[model samples]
Target: MTRTLVDPHSVPAELRPYLQELVHRTHSVCGPHLVSVIAVGSVALGDYRHGRSDTDVTVVVDGALPGRALPGLATALAHPALPCPAAGLELVVYDEDFAARPSGAAGYLLDLNSGPSLPGKVSLDPAQSSAFWYVIDRSVAHQAGRVLYGSPAREVIAEPARADVLAALRASVREHSTGAGHLADNRVLNGCRSVQFCRTGRWQAKRRAAQAVAASEERFRPLVNAALRSYERPSRTAAAALPTADVRAFLAWVAERVDETAV
Candidate 1:
């Protein structure tokens, strides 16, 4: 059996009202079909910065959710209506069976990306898979996701293969290198995260991973520091932009380390 989150205080003080509203509205819309609500990413990881990190939530519903529940849930949780307190809300809905068992591929009923600056994507099709990021996020959720409203994550979430997860991390580094993904904070910090995962097979906090890289990898310290400093800021201004060449080289270095250390 898996353990649920033991301490209510584990969830930070400042975000409680938003979380309360989240749970209330979610229960209102999802009703009995909703099985679990797990908080992944920064909130679960204990390094959330209100203005910087989004409310990352994964909802599990009983398998075979009715058609009506989809849009109802979307509207209920979409920003402005629910009023996300963080940078935004990264929310995904999965059925109980899908979330509770191990699988080789990625799937979801809905991926609602909403915020003031977000894409406002209400992804409903299981056919459209963003496996690179999705798989990695799911893997992290399995290991670190804290229970908000359901069984413990260890009982409800499946464990993905280490190799598959690392492959996605490598793909992410490559994607940024090619300019397909270009957020400076994500690119630089994700590079640190990728290398850290390859070494430990654990998705620790990005800032912590960057700090680890800085301490051990002398050659990359300055670049890693720049990434860390930029990541801590409230917003990404032009001054926060990391050197393109250094970013590329750091990602290249991360790729090589991933190849070497991946289990």
Candidate 2:
């Protein structure tokens, strides 16, 4: 079954006009080559917080956009005249072939992150890399994505393999836990969600995932609560309130559990 488009009214008032403009501009730039533009992540999930959240979009094109199109799209998106309304906009461009066919590979034509602060920034050089995360993203888009243009998301995006999804989650947890400093709120909350998904094959938002972890595991309650607070009201003080050592210990424990389950 196809998912319904996100109710425009549900979008943040400040962000709605900008999002509409973005879709219009994207269509103008891509022309007929553009397959669809999908709104994903928090905005699509109805959990967006004006200043804290980001506007995530997936642009599916017919094929690799010509080299010249890149700069134009970047310039258009980052024009000082049209200011971004959130922390930033994270947009990933993928080819229809890639979306229709799930390859356990990593590569994207354009991965653009731009906003008023960082105008016209593009990360396309490393076109080839392990894109395990894209698999999970595709799954998200297929299930919950909001289509701004073109057909239903399921028509253009394929379901990711369960193993690939697990691999991506494992990689994310490892990356987050490798450092020694206090973990970011997203890192802590996402780590919990990843563990939960690995164990139960159910995906949930970060806060809900933290609640689930707290409900099931008494040992993780304190750290999870700290993360939840940080997620709710993101601030350096809230983040610093977390017990760094305990957070690391919890992450390590989660890593071990994920590893055990994988085995």
Candidate 3:
């Protein structure tokens, strides 16, 4: 049976109209081939911090999207054409085959990373060389994503294997562990979430997972709480840095622990 697409009522009120246009524009591009559009990441997870979380989504098509439709679709949803209200908008489009049975390669028909401040990016490859993250995203979407259009998410998004997810989690820490632009709070909170996911096999909001880490691992409470505060209400200006050494140590510890887990 062919499923109908609708703007999800459960999303944040501000996003309702924006998403309506998103779905409408997407359908116009893909025509009847559009399958589903699943909302994922912080916005879908209910931990969306205004000015922090990006409006992330996955668009699925029955078959491959026509190459000619790419430019128009990308241009329409990107920055100036369709301004994003959140920190930015991150959207990926995949055909039904890959959406139903994902791989670690991170192939996509279209990948858009548009933000208000950050430069816009349109990619067809794993531009950052982190294909595994897309695989992990599919897992998160399958488990916790909300349906914004077309079929129910689970009906299209197949969960990636546990081993693949854990592997990706381990790889993910490297970028955040030590980099010029890596934020202190983001590193700490991300580390906590990685640890929590390893132990529970669940996808949790960064703050919730940080709280759990603090409650159980008292050693990291101070760091976790600090990060939580920053994440909940991010500052417009710079704040005191969380010790880089400490954040790196925690992430390394998380990677080791994740590697040890039975996937």
Q: What is the lDDT of residue 141 in candidate 3?
A: 90
Clashing residue pair totals per candidate (backbone < 3 A) = 0, 1, 0
Q: Predictions ranked by lDDT, top down?
A: 3, 1, 2
The candidate maximizing lDDT is 3
Model 2 scores a C-alpha lDDT of 0.72
Model 1 CA deviation exceeding 4 Å by range: 1-7, 237-239
Arrange candidates by TM-score, descending: 3, 1, 2
Give the lowest summed-lDDT range of ten residues in model 1: 1-10
lDDT head-to-head 2 vs 3, winner: 3
Query: 1 or 2: which has the higher TM-score?
Result: 1
How big is the positional error of residue 185 in model 2, measured in Å on the Cα after superposition? 1.3
* TM-score, one value per model: 0.92, 0.86, 0.92
- Give the least accurate 10-residue stretch of model 3, judged by summed lDDT: 1-10
Instruction: Give the best candidate by TM-score.
Output: 3
Summing lDDT over every window of 10 consecutive residues in candidate 2, give the lowest-scoring window. 1-10
- Ranking 1 against 3 by lDDT, winner: 3
* lDDT accuracy of residue 132 in candidate 1: 71
